[model samples]
Target chain A: MIEVKHLTKKYGDLVAVNDLNFKVEKGHIWGLLGPNAAGKTTTMRILTGYLPATDGQATVADFDVFEQPNDVKKVIGYLPESVPLYPEMTVTEYLGFVADIKQIPKAKKREAIEKTIVTSGLRSVRGRLIKNISRGYRQRVGIAQALIHDPRILILDEPTTGLDPAQIIEIRELIKSLKGERTIILSTHILAEVTQTCDGAVIINDGFLMASGSLEELTASFAVKKAGVHIRLRSASAEASALFKNMAGVKDVRPQDGGFTIEWSPGADLRDDVTRLVVEKDMGLLEMRPLGMNIEDLYLKIISGGMPQ
Target chain B: MKNIWAVFKKETKCYFTSPVAYVVIFVFLILTGFFFHSLISWFNTQSMQMAQNPYYMQQININQMVYSPLFHNISIILLLVIPLLTMRLLAEEKKIKTDELLYTSPISVLQIILGKYLAALFVLFVMLALTGVYSLFTFAYGNPELPAILCGYLGLFLMGAAFMGVGLFFSSLTENQIVAAVLTFGSLLLFWILNWAAFSAGAFWKDTLNYLSFFQHFDDLTRGILDTSDLVYYASFAFFGLFLTHSVLQSRRWR
Candidate 1:
C-alpha cells in the first residue's frame, strides 16, 4: 500500500534520509527500527507528504506524495513524533475538529468521532481538556485524531515514546488489534516491540538503509554460522566435549562447567543427531538450545561495520 | 471549498475555545473604552466652556465626529494587538509539530491560510461590533454624518484586515509565537513610521513613501471621503499578504 523509492531528505549539508527504498504491502505492520537520528522519522514524514523529499518518489495507495498529495493524505493517518495536539481543546472537541478537517461527511462526523473515541480507548476522558490529561492520554488522543476519519494507512512515529510501561502495553495492544485492517508503518527504537507487533522491519543507521526484512531474516543475516546446541549437564570433562565435537554436523565444541556447547556448520541440521549422540553416550541432555541473534547484535554489526548504501 | 469551510470552522472553534481570543478581545475593549471616555470628556469640556460662543464653532472643530476617531484609534490599536492575536496562527502548529496533521490532511495551503485569516478577522469584527455602543453615544451627544461614520469604520476594518494579513505572513515564517509577534510589530511600525520620512524626503519621494504607508490609504476615509483607490489599496494589501503567507507555508516543506 506504500512505496518509497530512492527517497532522500537533506537538511542543508546533512542528509536525514539517503536513497531509501522500501514497500509496505497491504495488511501488514512494518516496523521502522533505527537508533537516534536514523532517518526513520524523516522517512515517515516524507511518506506522509508533510516534508518534500530532496530527491525521489514516494506514494501511498498509488497516489504520488509529491504530485497527488491530497489523495495520499486522504488514505493515510499520521501521528507525528511529538504528538501535536491543541492543549486547550477537550478530547471530544479535538477529535470532532479532526473529523471536520479530514472532511468526513456531516452525517458520519458524529459516528466517526464516537468510533475513534472507542477505538482509541478514550471514552472516559473525552471531556477532559488535553492539557490536563497525562502523557498517555495525550497520546491516545493523538491516535484518536489520526484514526477519526478511518484512513486506510496509519503511520505512527514513536507512538509509545513517553508513556509508562502499562500505557505502552496498552498502546501496543491497540496497535496490534489494528493490524490486518490497515497498513501501518510503526517507527521506534524499541526492538522487542517490533518483534511482537510488526510482521517485517526496516533497519536504518546514519541516514542509510542498513537492512530490511522479517525480524528473523535480518537477525540471521548477522550470523556467520547458525548457532548450535548449548548443553548444561551434571558432570562432563574435556574428553566428552571432544567426543561431542567429533559427532556428525558438529564443527566446534567448547567445554563448559558440566557440558559442552557445540556449533553447527551452515546449512546443517544437528538437532536429532546430537540428541542421538547424547542418548548413546548416556550424558544427561540437560539443556540444548540455539542461540538466535537479536536485532541489537545485528544492528551493531551493520552500524559499526558501516554497511554499504 | 468544503475543505476551506471545514478549516474555517475548526480554526474559529479553536479561537473561541482558547483563552487567546478572549484575552485579545478584553484588552482591545479596555483600551478602546479608555480612548472613547477621554474623547467624550474633551467634547464635554469644550461644549461647556463655549456655551454662548456660537459663530460656526461646532462646524470649525468637528472633534465631536466621534466615529472617525474611534475607528482611527482602533486601527492604531490594531497595529499593537493584531500581532498578538495572529502570532500563533501557523507558527505554534509547527513548533508543537501539529502542522504535520494539518499539512497531511486533505485541505490545501490556501484553505488553511484563509481559515486562520478569517478567524482572526472574525475576532476583530466582533471587537468592532462591541464598540458600537460608542457610536450610539456619539448619536446621543451630537448628530454626525452617518455616511462619513460608516466610511471611516469600513476603512478601519479594511486596514485592520491588511495588518492581520501581514501578521499571518510573519507567523508562518517561525515556530515561536513570541518571535512572530515581535517581528510583525517591528514591520508594522516601520510601515507606520514611513509617513514621517515624507517631511525630509521632498514631494516626489514623500508621495512615493506615502503610497507605501499603511495609514496613508486610510486617510481619505477617516476624513469622510470614500476614494475607490484607497479601498482597492486595502483590499489588495490584504490579498497580497494572505497569498504570501500561503506560499511561505508551501515552501516550508521543501526547506
Candidate 2:
C-alpha cells in the first residue's frame, strides 16, 4: 500500500533521511526498527506527507503523496511520536474533532468514533477530559484518533514508547489484531516488538537503511556462525562429551549449564543421530535444543558495524 | 470550503472549551472597561464649557471616542489579546506535534490557515460586541449617531482582522507559543510606533509614510468618514497577512 523510492530529506546540512527505499505491501504490518534519532520518525513523517522529501518520491495506496496529497491523506492515518492532542477536549470530543478534520462523512463519523473508542478500549473514559486522563489512556486516545477514519494505512511512530510492559502488550495486541485489515508501518527501538508484531521490518541507523525483509529473512540473512545446540546426558559423564563432539555433524562442543553444547554443521539435522548415539551408549538423553537468534543480538548485528548481509 | 469550516468549528470550539479562552475574555473585558471609563473621565475633565456644548456633549463625537483615543486603546489591547488568541493557533499544533495530523489530513493548507484566522476573528467579534454596552451609555444620555457607531465598528473590525493576520503569521513561524505571542506583540508595537517616527521626520516624509500607517487609516474611520481608500487598505492588510501565513505553511513542506 506504500512505496517509497530513494527518499531523501535534508534540513540544510543535516540529512534526516538519506536514499531510503522500501515498499509496504497491503495487509502486512511492517516495523521500522531503529535507535533514537535514527531517521525512523523522519521516514514516517515523509511517508505521511507531514514533511516532504528533498529528493525522490513516495506513494500511498496508489496516490502520489506530493501530487495527490489529499487523496493519499484520505487513506492513511498517522500517529506522530508526541501523540498530539488538545488537553482541554474530552476523549470523545477530541476524536470527534479529528474525525471532522479528516472529513469522515458526517453520517459515518459517530459510528466510526464509537468503534474506535471501543477498539482502543477508551469507552470507559470517553467523557473525561484529555488532560485528566492517564498517560496510558491518552496514548489510547491517540490511537483512537488515528483509527477514527478507518484509513487503509496507519503510520505510527513509536506507538508503544512510553507505556509500561502491560500497557505495551495491550497496545501491541491491539495493533496485532489490526494486522491483515490494513497496512501498518510503525517505528520503534524495541526489538521484541518487531519480533512479535511486525511481519516485515526495515532496520535503519544514522539515516541509512541498514536492512529490510521479513523477520525470518532478517534473522536468516544474519544467521552467520551457526549457533550451537545444547544436549545433556543424564547418565553419561566426561567420556560421552568427546563421543558426542566427534559425531559426524558435530563441529565443536563445550560444557554449559552442567551439560554439553555441540555446534553442528549448517543445514544438518542431528536430533536423530544424537538420539541413536544415546541409545547405543546407554546414556540417557536429558535435553536437546537448537539455539535461536534473539532480536537484540540480531539488532546489534545489523547496526553496530556488524556484517550488513 | 467544507474542510475550512470543519477546521473553523474545531478551532472555535477549542477557544470556548479551554481555560485560555475564558482567561482572554475576562482580561479583555477588564482592560476595555478600564479604557472606556478613562475616555469618559478624560472627556469630563475637558472643561465644562466644551463639555456642556450640546453638540459636543450630546453627540459625543464618536470619532473622538472610537477613532482617536479609544481606537488606539483597543489597538493596544489587540496587541495583547490577539497574540493570546493566535499563539496557540499553529504553535500549539507544532509543539504537540499534531501538525502531522493536520498536514496528513485531507484538508488543504489554506483551509487550516483560514480556519484559524476566522477563529481569531470570532473572538475579536465578541470583544467588539461587548463594547456595545459602552455605546449604549452614550445613547442613554445623548443622541448618538448610528452611522458613526457603525463606521467605528467597521474600522475596529478591519483593524482587528489585520492584527489577527499578523498574530497568525507569527504563530506559524514558531513552535514555541510563548515566543510566538511575544514576537507578535513586539511586531504590533513596532507598527504602532512607526507613524510617530514617520511624523517626527517632518511633512514630506510624513505625507509619504502616512499612507502606510494603520492608525492613519483608522483615524479617518473614527472621524465617521467612510473613505473607500482606508477601507480598502485594511482589507488588503488583512489579505496580505493571510497570504503570508499561507506561504509560510507551504514553505514548511520544504523544511
Candidate 3:
C-alpha cells in the first residue's frame, strides 16, 4: 500500500534520508528495523506527507504524497515518535476530538471513539485525563487516536519504546493481533519486536536501505556458509581433533576444555559422519548439535555488510 | 468548514480547561471596572458643577465623557491582555509536538488559522459582553448616545481582532510562549505609539507615521464616525497577519 522511490531529505549539508527505496504490500505488517538516526522516522514522515521529500517521490494508497497529500492523509494514520497528545483531555474526549478532525460523520463519531478505545484497550481509562495515565496507557491512547479513523495504512514510529517488559509484550501482542487487517509499518531498533510482531522487515543503516524481505527470507538470504558445532567427548585429545578434521566436509576443529568445536561448509549434514567417526575412534561423544542463525545474527550480518548468500 | 468548527471547539475548550482564560478575563473585568468607576465619578462631578451654575451653557456629551473613555481604556487593556489569550495558540502546540497531529490531518492550514483566530475573538467577545453591564448602568441614570456607544464597541472589537491576529502570527513563529507573549506585546506597543514619531519627523514621515497608527484610526470611531477606510484597515491588518501565519505553517513542511 506504500511505495517510496529514491526518497531523499536533506537539511543543508546533512541528509536525513538518502535515496531510500522500499514498498509495503497490503495486509502485511512491515517492521522498519534501524538504529537511532537511521532515517526511519524521516522516511515515515515523508510517506505520511508530514514532510516534503527533498528529491524523490512517495505514494500511499495510490495517491501521490506530493501531488495528492490530502488524499494520502485521508487513508493513512500516523503516530509520531513523541506520541503527540493534549494532556488536558480525557481519553474519550481526545479520541472524540481526533474523530471529529478526521471527519467521521457526526452520527458515527461516538461509535468510532468507543470502538477505538476498546481496540486499544483504553476503555478502563476512558474517563481519566491523558496526563494522569501511565506511559503504557498513554501509548495506547496514541494508538487509539491513530486508529479512530480506521485508515487503511498505519504508520507507527517506535510504538513500544518506553514500556516495561510486560507492557512491551502487551503492545507487541496488540500489534500482532492487528496483522492481516491493515498495512502496518512500524519502526524499531529492537530486533525481537520485529521478529515477534512483523511478517517482514526493512533493515536500514546510515539512511541506506540495507535489506528488505520476509523474516525467513532475510534470515536465509543473509545466512553464513559456515556452521559451528559444539561437541563434548570423553576422549578430548589431539588425535580426536585430527580425526574430526580429516573427515569429509569438516573445515576446522578446535579443542576445548571438555571437547572440541567443529566448523563445516553449508548444505553438508556431518552429524552422521561425525557420529560414526567418534564411535570408530572410541571418542565417547557426549553431545553434538548444529547452531542456527537467529534474527540478531542476521541483523548484525546485514548491518555489517557481511551477507554470505 | 466542519474541520474549522472542530478545531474551534477544541481550542475554546482548551482555553477554559486551563487557568489562562479565567485569569485574563477576571483581571480584565476588574481593571475595566475600576476605570469605569473612576470615569463615572468624574462625569458626576462635572454634571454637578454644571447643575450648580446655570450660567454655564457648554453641555457635556455623556458619550464623550463616559462611553468613549470607557471603550478607549478597554482597548488599551485588550492590547496588554490579548497576547496572553493568544500566546499558547500555536506556540504551545509546537512545544508539545501536537503540530504533528495537526499537520498530518486532512485539514488545510487556513482552517487551523481561522479556527484559532475565531476562538480568541470569541473569548474577547465574552469579555466585551461582560463590560456591557457598565453601559446598562449608564442607561439607568444617564442618557448616553446609543449609536455612539455602538460605534465605540465596533472599533474596540475590530481593533482587538486585529491585535489577536498579530499575536497569533507571533505565536506561530516560536515554540516559546514567553517569547511569543513578549514579542506580541512589543509589536502592539509599537503600533500603539506609531503616531509618536509624527512630532519629530517632517511632513512625509509624519503623514506616513500617522496613517500607520492603529490609534489614529480608532480615534475617528470613538467620536462616532463610521469611516469605511478604518474598517478596511482593520480587516486588512487581520488578513495580513493570518496570511503570514499560514505561510509560516506551510514553510514548516519544507524544514
Candidate 4:
C-alpha cells in the first residue's frame, strides 16, 4: 500500500509538484495521468528516494519515504523514464547485480533471478549484452531488473513511451500479469493505458490534482457536460426514448445519429438499470457508449480546465 | 560491505571487459621498460668509468644513480596515466545514468564511492606490481639496497593514490569523460608545479607552498628516507580527494 499526503516538490523557485495527495490499496494498479512537465517524473523520484521532496510525506508499505528511506528502498523497485542500464552487462548479469545490492540472500538469489526471468520473458536474451538488444528488449530488461528484488511496491515512469505497437501490447500484458501481487503505480500520457490496465487513476495537471477515482467514478464526474450513457437499438423506435427516461437518476435524453444519448445526474452509473430496462421492453440493444467512456475524453475534458463548478 | 563489494566487482569487471585495462597496463609497462633499459645501461657505463679511479669508486652508488631517478621518472608517468583509469569511474555512470540504479538500490552513497575508488586503487596496484619486475632484474645483477627500493615503490603507490583521489573528484564533477580527464590533468598539473611558485614567495609562504606540493613529500620516499609525516601526507591527501567527491555526490541529492 502507498499513501502520499500533501506532497510538494520545488526546484528552487519552480514548483514542480504542488500539494498532491493519493492512495493505493494493496494489489491495485493505479495510473498517474498527466501531460508533459506535469511533475510525474519528479514525484516518482521523490518516492523512490532518488530525489528529496521539498515538503510533505509519502509512505510505501507503511514506511515513511523521508524518515526511513533505506527501509523504504528495500521494499520499492523503480524504473526511471530513460531506462538507465549498463550496456556492457548482459541481461542476466545486470539482474544479478541488482539482486546483489538489494541484499537478496545468497540462497534465494538464483531463485529470484530465475523467477523474474520467466516472469518478464527475458530467458531468450539472457546472455546478450544490453546494448546489443532491441529497444523493446531493453525495456523488458529494465522491468526485469526492478522485479529481481520483488519489492512490495513498484513504480514505473512511462514504461512504454518508446515502443512499437506490438511491443507496447507485450509490455502492457507483462504489467497486467503482475497486478495482483503488488501495488503498482505507472505514469503515462496515454489514455487507453489507464482504462485498459489500471483499477483506478490519479489525474494531475500543472502538479495539481484535477480529479481522481475509479474508472466509473471519473467517467461520472462533472467534467462531462451532459454526463451519461448513450445507447442504440437494433431497430429505430420512438418508444426507446421513453424507456430510458422513466428510469430514476435520468436527467435528460437526446438523439445522436442512430442512438439516444442519455444524460444522468452526476455520479450515477445507469448502465445496469438501462440494460435491464432494454430487456424488459423486448427491444434489441445494438450498442451503449457512455459519455467520456474512455479516459481520453475525460482526460481532455478535465485538463482543459473544464471541470464543472 | 557487500554493497561495496558489489560495486567494486562491477567496476573492476567493467575495466577489464572493455579495452581500457589492457590498453592502460600495456602502455604503462612499455614506457617503464624503456626507462629501465636506459637507466640500467647508463649506470653500467658510468660505473665502468668510475672504476678506473680508486677514489672515484667510492661514489659508485646505484641507489642514487639508478633507483632514485627511475622512481622520480615513474611518478611523472603516473601523472599522465592515472587519469585514464580514473576518468571513467564516476563520469560514465552519470553519462549513461546508471547512477540512478546505483542510488535507488538499497546501498549507501559511501558504499558506491568506496567501491569505485577501491577498484581504481586495485588497478593501480596491478600497474605497480608489473613494474616490480624491473626491481627484480636490478636485484639479480647488482646489489641495490632492498629497503630503499621497496620504500620507493611505497612512495610511488601513495603518490598514485593521491593522484587517483584527485582524478575521482574530477570524474564526479562532470558527465563528459573528456572534461573529467582534462580537468583532472589540469588541476593535477597545477599541484605538481605548485612548489615552483614557492621560489619567489616570502619565507613563510615558501614553506607552505612546498609542503602543499605533491612532489615535496614524495621526494623523501624516493631516497628511502622514510618518515611518518610523509606517509600521513599521501594517505590524507588521498582521503581528502575522496572526501571532496563524497561531498559533491551528497550535495547533488539535496539540490
lDDT to native, each model: 0.84, 0.84, 0.90, 0.89
Q: In candidate 1, what are the lDDT values of residues B47-74, reduced to their tens digit? A: 6667667864555344334556766788
When summed lDDT is taken over every stretch of 10 residues in candidate 2 chain B, the lowest stretch is B59-68
The reply for model 2, stretches above 4 Å from the true place, is A225-228, A231-240, A246-249, A256-259, A265-268, A272-288, A291-296, B41-68, B200-204
RMSD of each: 2.9, 3.1, 2.6, 4.3
- Model 3 pairs whose backbones collide: none
| Predicted candidate 4 versus true structure: per-residue lDDT over A194-297, tens digit per residue | 99889988898888887778887777663435468878877546778876778899998887777788888877888888889888887788898867545677
Q: Model 1 RMSD to the real structure?
A: 2.9
Query: What is the TM-score of model 4 when looking only at chain B?
Result: 0.98
Interface RMSD of each: 1.5, 1.2, 1.0, 0.9
Worst 10 residues of 1 chain B by lDDT: B58-67
> lDDT of model 1 at residue B233?
83
Task: Give lDDT: candidate 2, residue B37.
Answer: 85
Candidate scoring better on DockQ of 1 and 2: 2
TM-score of chain A of each: 0.87, 0.88, 0.89, 0.80
Order of the predicted models by lDDT, top scorer first: 3, 4, 1, 2
Off-target runs (Cα >4 Å) in candidate 1 are A216-223, A232-250, A255-260, A264-287, A292-296, A306-309, B57-65
Model 4 regions more than 4 Å off: A223-294
lDDT, residue A200, candidate 3 = 91
* Per-model DockQ against the true two-chain complex: 0.67, 0.72, 0.76, 0.66
> What is the C-alpha lDDT profile of model 3 across B1-255, one tens digit per residue?
999999999999999998889999999999999999999999889988887777653577788888878878998999999999999999999999998998898999899999999999999999898999898999999788889888988999999999999999999999999999999999999988999989899999999998888999999898899999999989898998899999999997777
